[model samples]
Target: MKRVAILGGGPAGAFAAEQLASAGWQAVLFDEKLAWEKPCGGGLTYKAYSHYPFLLENSTPKRFVTETVLAAPRAGAVSLQLDQPLLIYSRFDLNRLLLDRAERAGAQIEQARVLEITRQGSRWRVLTNHGSADADFCIVATGARNPLREVGTQLTACDTMSALGYYVPGEQSMIDIQFLPRLEGYIWIFPRCSHLSVGICGKGEPAGALRKRLEQYMTEREIPWKHGSFYSHLLPSLHTASWRRNRVTGEGWLAVGDAAGLVDPITGEGLYYAIRSADLAVRALLSEVTGLAEKMNLYQRLLRRDFAGDLEFGSRLARRVFHGRFLWASVPARMVQFTRSSPRFSAIMRDLFAGRQSYLDLRQRLLKNLNGSLYEMWMSLGFRRLVPRKAA
Candidate 1:
């Protein structure tokens, strides 16, 4: 049997191992820290659960949130009732769940840090701290902070964003998204099973500045983040140009998840992409193409045909969505107001939150509904103006 060396036992690596092993391939996964917590909100959208029902059917501890509050400067706040609830899981729990599934599928799991990966003719030689392993192929699922420089997407300062936050001790039913005045990112408060993941992520900003902004927001809202555990990490938010040249696959190996920079630039969503990319990679490797170079090319084509193109478009729109002005207000502010006053726009926002909406067609949808949305907003304002005032 052909052996495959899978690096990084996160969602992508674990899922790939599970699929490959189930298909009768010899799969071995390596990771020093197999399961751990991350700073970002670990929420899976409807698109994820619908594609992979096991994610929701599992016995892992998770939270289902059906409500979200979106707030923006000068636009106040608007409450959105999600038609499809979000599945929130602690990163550690989620990682453990995937790893368990992989192990049960006959994958050999190793708890050792990968020191280096060298190509040996047509095979691979993986050197770990504990020992070395030889495999016919390699799968790089290492995250954004990948230590192996020879593999995965080469990320520059502009291709990443700083994500930092605290796991606050609290409980809530709804999710909170706060958009700042001039920042290229936003703040999120996602309610997990036991605690809240309150964090901020921004591009072209230092982690220290993002942390200060998050702390200020927490203080203003009386969230008591001082007593919470702090965490920070980098998220892949590749530029449009970077996507065209993204290094996903090469000879005898392929990269998956954050290592390949398969993340939603606008929303910072990676779980779905990670799982989806892993599935695609396995499919490509298992295809009857026979040629190694052909399999690598097939994987690239599958990714672009599936979701990479959409994410590339999103990267182009990220700046405008966060900082662009619309009708004398910021784009985020207008988005909040539109969602509050227009049912048409609210439906769009709901779909976007559920991951059912694609960025490639967002502009078309917005332009098509602009006139009707504006009329609805005007009518809402008129009705509010006609309401009787209380005693002043």
Candidate 2:
């Protein structure tokens, strides 16, 4: 069996390990912080459940959210019912579950941090705290701070974000989002199995500022957030200029998840993208083709075909929705009204939330809803005019 070495025990690495190991490959997964609690919302979309059904199996501690409340600056809030429920899990629970699946599928778990990965001929050498190992292929799923410069990948600060939040006790039946004033990120209350994962994320914002904003939001919402465990972490966000040239695959290796910067810039939602990319990578790695170059090319093609546009489009939409001029902004409120009024509009949002919608057609979806809304307004006006004449 061909051997593969994967660095990182997050969704991407673990999922890849599971797929490769189940297919009879010797897959070894490495991570120093295996099953550590990450400061993430841990929401899984519809596609995640459908594509990987096993995620919801075996009594995973998760909460189902059916409603999402969107709050725009000074425009109040609007609630949209999700056609499909979202699954929210604690990061630790979710990571542990995937790692366990990988191990069960025959992937060896190594609790060591990979220090370097260098290609030697057809195989790659991985140096970890435990020891050095050689594999036919290497997967750099070690997140945005990956040290594999040989893989030709870099995550700049401009394209990254800093997120901070608290884990507090709460009853979570729905998800809540409050748009930041012209910022690239928002404050969110995501209900996990036992508590609430509330946080504020902003690109280029200092930690102190984000903390102050979180405190203010906590106060306004009356969440009783005092004495909760606080967390801060760095996450990758898509940048138009650099994301297009992200070198994800090379001679004897491939990068998945945050290592390749496969993150949604707008929402900072990466769980879906992470697993999906890993799935594609594993599929490509398992192909019977003989050439490593061909396999890497296929991997890049898969990413471009499947999700490049979505990430770019998400970045654009994020800027439009979260721009600080929202107190008098029509776009944000118009979107909320569209969601409130149009079933098609609501369905698209639901699809997006469900991970069934693509960014390729997001514009078309919005335009179609806008046209329908206008026609309804015109018809309503005509009927009112006719009613006045009949009364007269």
Candidate 3:
């Protein structure tokens, strides 16, 4: 059987190992912490479950969230419906489930830290705290704050967001997102089965400011948070430019998930991209269209094809919205009002958050609906502008 070595057994590595193992290939997964309590909210979008049905097979601690409340700066909160519910889980539970699935699929689990990797003749020599192993292929699935060496050397640096949050014991249902004025990120509350994952996140902002804002938000919302542990972490913010400059594969090795700069720069969502990248990487290797080197090259092509368009659009949209730019007929405040007043507008947002719509499709739909909304307003009530157009 062809052997593969996977470093950092997070969702990316674990999912890839499961796939390879199911296909009768030898897969070895190494991770120091197989079940980790990742600090941020652990919520997967709709298309995630749609793509991988097996994610819901286990009775792990999780919750299905349907409603969401969005609060723009200096605006009233707008409650919207998630037609396709979002699923939230504790990272420890989620990672444990991923590890269990991988092991059950015949992949060997190594609970050791990877120290270094060297390229030998037609093979990779991976050094671990326990020992070393040689494999035909290697995958680096280590996340944003990993200590692994330059496994994917060609990979460049991207902006990493400082994420700080708390898991408070509470009974809440709706997911809340509050946009900070002029900040490139937002604060959120993702409700789990028993507790709420609450936090603030931003790109290109002060760490102290993020905490101060989080505390202010908790106080204004009257959220008593003396119950759960507070934690802080880093999240990768790779949007269009970063995507264009980075390559996930080289020679006999490939990078997946955060290591590959696959996370959404805007939403800070990487679950879908992580699993998707690993799946495509395995397919590219298994194809062996030419040789291992050529197959790996194909992996890069596949990632670009699958990820580029949406990422570019997301990056542009984030700049416009978060930086307070106007979108033809709307700024952030006007856009929130549009969502509050128009069911059609709300549906588009629902799809965007639920991962059901691509950025390209969302842009097209919003533009088309803008004209219709204008016409509707003119015919009914002499054209009231929900979103005011800024003077150029």
Candidate 4:
């Protein structure tokens, strides 16, 4: 049996551990915290529902009215009410379930921080706070801003985008996505069980001012609330140019999940990619049966074929939306409504949302309707003498 080493006991690492263990491979997982609490928007988009059907059974899954309320400094506001519902749950509970499932699948997990990694001949050695470990293969799910900074990995730095959110009694259940012109990012409001999660994020140095501005926005809008005392942690905003350098599959090393820059950019969602990449990595390693290097090669190829388009498209979309006031203003709501109104558009949305098709599939559709899209986007942007910024 091949020995697999998984770094970080988050969703990505745990998923990989589970997949490998179920396939009879020995899997070991390590993380800094035995019980880590992730401070995310806590809203799981429908896009993730297909992969995590059991998310609704988490006992704390909060029922939020499935409507997207969008606001922008430029184009005012627009709301989207969908027949499909969206749900939110505590990140703490969600992660625990996955960890439990992985343990049940027979994967050994160690709550220790990995300090260093070295390669020797056909094996990789990982040094942790507790001790050292050797494995036939290594999976890096250390996330975007991991401090290890191993040489040869394609690393990128991102500006700090601040967010502070929490839940309080009598909070309304609505998913509000707000964009600020002064701030480079947006704020999100997601309902979680009895409490609500609300926070703001954006690029640039105005984050402190942005937070206060958000507080003011909430108060002015008469959104009844209190500023939760616990400060929200910083979320690393980066995606490496390349997930793997010399080779994805080396003598005995592989990269998966955020370490590989596989998160969805637009939604800031990484769980689905983490789980999907883990599944692919384990599947490939299992098929190898002997030559571990060959397994990594297959895993890399599969990930490229299956996810390259979405990753690229999402990055492009993220850049465009954040860099300008057009798309997030009123364009997104208008475009989504316009696209979903037609049967053809509905099918396309289904395929894309279901992950059955790549972003390339939607690209062609968008291109075919580029003229209409541009016109709608222009109208939504106010059509009042402002020029759309050139695409990056």
Q: List the residue pairs that clash in candidate 4.
A: 167-196, 185-202
Candidate 3 regions off by >4 Å?
153-158, 327-330, 375-392
Greater lDDT among 2 and 4 belongs to 2
Clashes (backbone N, CA, C under 3 Å), per candidate, total: 0, 3, 0, 2
Report the C-alpha lDDT of model 1 over 14-51, residue by residue, as the tens digit: 99999999999999999999988855699999999999
| Candidate order, lDDT descending | 1, 2, 3, 4
TM-score of each: 0.99, 0.91, 0.92, 0.79
Ten contiguous residues with the weakest lDDT in model 3 = 375-384
In the predicted model 1, the residue pairs found to clash are: none
Give the candidate number with the greatest lDDT. 1
Top of the candidates by TM-score: 1
Ten-residue region with minimum lDDT total, candidate 4: 239-248
TM-score of 3: 0.92
lDDT of 2 by residue, 214-287 (tens): 99989988997896899988888867887778889877788999888998887788898889999999888788
Higher lDDT: candidate 2 or 3? 2
Error of 3 at 8 (Å): 0.8
